[model samples]
Target: MNVVEVKGTELEDAFQIRREVFVEEQGVPLQDEFDGYDESGAAARHILVYYEDQPAATGRLRWLGDTAKLERICVRAAMRKFGLGSVVVKSLEKIAQEEGFCKAKIHAQTQAQNFYERLGYRQTSEEFMEDGISHIVMERTI
Candidate 1:
């Protein structure tokens, strides 16, 4: 798997991946899935993972003060269990640190809490519903 940071026109493919996983696959409302953040946020970093020349996974990073939030992480359904999710998180962490953020945060879907835990994220709050799915805030200090 290869992780690359891309923006502008290069982000189209990543947006498509997010639509597939967050909108189509998960039934999340399309309006909630793609937001204004994609256009106005200067600190937004988009990561795309390619396997054998095909896009395999996608994620986004948004710098908020001293912290960075990893959001909209998704792996193609057929690529689940192949470690692409972990790879995406690790890549985001590296990018955050490189950009001077000392901490990283994510609103992880409840079902994937254990996955984030294994990646060093600690649950920081009670589970809450977001986009009709249960999620919890998790954070990791780099």
Candidate 2:
């Protein structure tokens, strides 16, 4: 698998991956999934992973002040359990740090808390519901 930084036309693939996982699979209302952040977020960085020349996973980083929030992380269902998700996160974290972010945070789904923990992210709050799904805030200092 290979990870690549994407922008402009290349970002369509990453957006589609998020739409498939968050909107279509998880039912996270389409309107809420795609928002105003796309056009003006100078800190936004998208990372896409490909396997055998096919897009297999994707994620994005949105910087807020000194912190970079990693969001919409997802691997194509058929590509799960293959470490593609980890690759996507690690690559994003590297990019975040290189960009001078002091920390990285993510709102991890409750079911995936352990996964994030294994990746060095620690839960910073009790579980909460967002758009009907349980989630918790996790963070890792860069």
The candidate that wins on TM-score is: 1
For residues 33-122, could you state the per-residue lDDT of candidate 2 as single tens digits?
Answer: 876655434557788999989998998889777789998899999899799988988998999888878799999999999999999999
Residue 9's lDDT in candidate 1? 83
TM-score of each: 0.95, 0.93
Off by over 4 Å in 2: 40-42
Question: Which candidate number would show the highest lDDT if scored against the true structure?
Answer: 1
Give per-residue CA lDDT, model 1, range 1-142, as digits (tens). Answer: 6789878888888888998999998899988998877874465888999977889899999888888999999999988878999999999999988988889999999999999999999999999999999999999998
- TM-score quality measure for candidate 2: 0.93
Model 2 weakest lDDT span, ten residues long: 34-43
Residue pairs in candidate 2 whose N, alpha carbon or C atoms collide under 3 angstroms: none
